[model samples]
Target: MSYAGALWLAVQEDLYTGICNGTRENGDINRPKIIREESKGCLECFDDYFLSQCFHLSRPCLTFLLDFIKTRLKKNVFNPVSDSTSTESIILATLFFYAHGFLPSKITAKLGLNHTFAGEAVNTTSKILSELSSSFITFPASYNDRMGVAQGFKNISGIPNVVGVLGCFHVKVTPPPSELSLFLNTLGYPSVTVQMVSDVDGNLLSVEQCYPGGTREQYVWERSTICQEFVSFRHGQTWVIGGRGLPPGRHVLTPVERSQLKTSAARRFNITHSRVMTYNQHVFGCLKARFQCLNDLGTVQADALESVACIIKACCVLHNISKKFSVPLPREPVLEPVHPTQDVKGKEGEKSFYYMEETREDMIETCFGQIRDEEEKEANTEGWL
Candidate 1:
């Protein structure tokens, strides 16, 4: 080639390379530079409030979490050598991501971490918590435990034999390429339905399962393992209370129709039922409030559905852990679940409905029948006097 032509080609190549590496001001994307935090000393400087502000966990709870998962995190999340990121930093970064819906790049910049470690930390941390879900978020299986939960519910709501409050909530997600309709909720947005059972104190007893955003709540419950347990009478003599929409069974109770509330006793019963049912609302509110990641799962995609589910389970486990340590919920606005307008009938058939209706009648008679008799007796005495 001629020297002049070769020189021209070289000049063009240099200009292209310069453009590729140019700053954002020059109409090119500038890659963020990582500034690694090498010293463990920085961690010592953060007070409890600051730690909670960043990670949404108290110091002792954070310590407990670190101690609880440090060994596994060391093995799974961090390398022994050549990985300078401390276990605490990784956890803090992951929790920061969960507490705030920050992008990985922002997290890296804030915590002095690289993109790779930040991503791995979130994945590993969620996996670890998901694995611990069975331990942390458990439904009472034993008779004694079930009874204790029942007693707690009765004390709080004055409703007898309510072992848990059953409900479902929605979490936003980006729809996948395949089966896109499954992820779109009734409100015309992509989401996943999280079915849950919570005890009186808003602690989750079971995260029964996650379903496609568009799945019906009644369908999810009918297929839920807890509902099966109830159907089989595995948790004997204990029934959960929910909205009138749920198909009531011998082990589950729902309020009567609005027409049935004509009597004062029936009105009282429905009010009490509502009081108990709202605990499920409280559980969802506190869970989402405590871990904002459940509110914004940006890292999640359609292909990684299982990962997102795990992350949700992990947040639930963390929620229970926070409750265990008495961690106060952050001061955030709690979003209420939308109530169903129409009733949802289960596939359990009419026979099951009659069976549960009988139980509800018996409960009402036991609770309010004597009061009615007393009122009549007092009226008679007043007339005589």
Candidate 2:
């Protein structure tokens, strides 16, 4: 190579490098900067629909949740080592992973996190949310609370003293590790059962999840915390209405036999009872509708039965929080489940009226809060002036 050519080449190389690096002042070194957040491509599901679909909430609701979490929960990383991933990013990414049912592998690129980190985010977020469930999902433990729930149900259905409605549904998912056989429903699909107790407005009062697909709704409800403490009858005559499968018990009641009972009162009872019970379907429909991840029917896979249950409990907590914040659920009413056989014949329990009595309206009005347990009686007597 000629000396002149070598000089020219060196000059050109320096100029090219200078142009690429821009000007460096003082001790600063000009180099290509790493883009941490925005450098990773954004997803189309990052807009309004993303917020609603991923978080099952709007901006305001997300803001509320974020604030609550940040305030109450410790700011901790999914892993002990500090990465560029922010706490906010971890939370948002975990929510997306859950809502979309994305595997940690798929969640990595979207969140600018590594595969293991994404997996960590999912675990930590669900654990934190489940721990916070008590603050959000609660049953009526006090008399005032019971009275309010009872009144709310009564107003909606005109079935006085109605406390809440019970229902259950199957959430399809990839089979869990150990109990793959137990997760299979009669329909020959793998699923897990989620039992819910909802008030008039589709607000979840109690959520019992993690049971196998074959688990009966009645069995789940019977084993739930709410059932043991439920004062079925508040106003002597008004009682907690159960799905057809749940036979009448001390703390619970189901409608009369429809085929055997043929009377105006029976029809009226069925109609009114159905009105309140319909929300049970509405709650599940709205939940699955809002959060598509919960409705996987088969696409989204659950890591384990426990993990899925944790997510469900978190969802129930969030659902109650949304209701408390007056977040409107799905607008249209979900139709009641159809059945050709006996009660609870379908996956969704559709409550149809059977029988109660010829007339109980006047009796209900006079007996508002007449029935009382020993504890309540003592408290009532103590407060009596």
TM-score of each: 0.79, 0.67
lDDT of each: 0.71, 0.59
Give the number of the best model, judged by TM-score: 1
Which residue pairs in model 2 clash with each other? 235-369, 270-353
lDDT of 1 at 240: 85
Per-residue lDDT of model 2, residues 1-385, tens digit only = 1123245334334433443344323543322222234443222223444345345566677777666655434545434423323555667766655544555343344445677776666667777787787777766766777778888876766565666787766677766466667676655667788777777767777777578776656667767766655534323434667767665554455665677445545555666666677778778877765555676634233335677777777777777777777765534435435221223532233232223332343333333323324457889899995
Model 2 CA deviation exceeding 4 Å by range: 1-50, 71-85, 103-107, 176-181, 186-188, 231-238, 297-304, 328-385
lDDT digits (tens) for residues 1-385 of candidate 1: 1123245334324433433344223442322222234453334444455456556788778878877776676666344422434666677777776776553464464456688877876777788888988899888899889889889987776668788888877788776567668777767777877788899888888896677777877788788888888777888888888766566667777887786666666677787888778778878887777777778575345455777787788889988999999987776547557655444754736464466686787787677566678899999999999
lDDT of 2 at 338: 23
